[model samples]
Target: MASSNQQVPYGYEPPQSNVRGTLIYYDDFNDITDAALEQAAIVAEQMRFAKLVLYPLHEQTVRRISNEQVAPFYKREQRLQEWKLDSGRKSILVEGWDGKRKKYTPIEAAIRTCMDHYSSPYFLLMTPEMANRFASFATFEEWITKISLVLTRQPDHLHPRMETFRSRWRVAGEQRDKNGKQSEL
Candidate 1:
């Protein structure tokens, strides 16, 4: 470690991070395709995130949250692992908290855990359907201010809360121009 007394070269400065924050892909991963994975990776890279964390919900959690049935968690997680390896993305990480708990994990708990572990300014990458579902939850208002949302695409319909907090979210492939107008990337 460099001491406080250590002097830097006259024209040199310490390295600073160009990448910022974490992009968390929060989903069940039951119907995610390889193309979707690529889109997520592309988003993370484009946004210059420090990491891309795939937080797959457990089957019970999915059932509780969305009232949808899904395949076993292991199968889904293994598939994600395989994809990560095949894609050769060093910054991609598969979070296993829900898998290890083996129970219905609440969205609030999941988000809190992620916030505790990852860097600040978190952005949740989710499909439009999932984003709408999340907005319908009771804790949506509380969480919305804590982190931003990046939907996979523009939603055909929006939850009332989502509509109310429109500024807190953006479409994944859309970026703001110099004048603050959104344009497709």
Candidate 2:
């Protein structure tokens, strides 16, 4: 039997999207510079991600993960806002879900929330140290395969798991070899 196709109205075709995936910048934002934020945005644009989410970790979350002291969450968020305004980038988003909770938010929860709210193919952007700390988490192996890592820069040292999963990550602005050494692009 032949199937008949129904004609659709002009200009009413299904919506199409050129971009694919979300680039989530998850960090404490204590010492993040405007330059670093710009780099992340640039990376997102270059990769053609639909959105660049700046997911700032609350102070408690920072302490639990790395015992590092961070400025108040409000202050950090304000800084992010200022950068967003100055950069005038509409695709940038500063997520405050963790701040609203006012306590430590596990990596698992943070990633899950992002997954639920954002588009597929999530890529986590973080500093070298933060990436290492995330690798130490029990859920690292489970989540690593689900999402890719984008380190601000290659780390001087590597966590064992990071080493084992080296193929799962890359430097933001440059390419590197298997040993984490800079390689020609």
Candidate 3:
């Protein structure tokens, strides 16, 4: 029994208690293998049946192996120079080197090998039924409310790595703030 004047949270519809229609979801294409595409398809199907839409997003296919793989090609002494030039600064670099040589695990090596040879495909899947259901919403705000609700309920639809990366980034930011406060004192 909330009042009309009360503000509603983003992606949440005030009048409607349940979410409906096809909701758009975005997922990154890290490695476009059969397994990866199959997973995307399965998630898409699950979402579609649940009355949600998924739109996987990929910026571009990484054409080369990550920097860690290529680091061995360059001389150890020249690593920093190469990094400053172009070798290690590429977007394909996932986990960067820690300034010390470290052994890569078998799984890591396998993933790098695959990335070196395969081209990642961008994924975007949506059903044709979306337009009809979307029209029922009165305003853009209402549509956003529905979309937000869908995303909130379906965490599995998101890219797992991205969430971990975001959490780490948040922790790092908090640590930086704490350090700055200590330095000022």
Whole-model Cα lDDT per candidate? 0.92, 0.91, 0.28
Ranking by TM-score: 1, 2, 3
Q: Residue by residue across 34-107, what tens digits does model 1's lDDT show?
A: 99999999999999999999999999999987899999999999999999999999999999999999999988
CA lDDT, candidate 3, residue 81: 36
Candidate 2 per-residue lDDT over residues 1-185, each given as its tens digit: 99999899987878887788999999989897888888899899877899999999999998998888989999999999899999998899999999999999999999999999999999999889999999998889999999999888869999999999988898887767667675645
Candidate 3 local lDDT, 1-185, one digit each (tens): 87578677888855742322332222222222444333433443443322222222212211121222222312332432333344222222222231232332222232233334333321113221222122233442333322222221223233333232222211101122444331110
Badly placed stretches (over 4 Å) of model 3 are 1-20, 23-25, 50-144, 148-185
Of candidates 3 and 2, the better by lDDT: 2
**Most lDDT-accurate candidate:** 1
Global Cα lDDT for candidate 2: 0.91
TM-score, predicted candidate 1 vs. hidden true structure: 0.93
- Evaluate residue 65 in candidate 2 and report its C-alpha lDDT on the 0 to 100 scale: 87
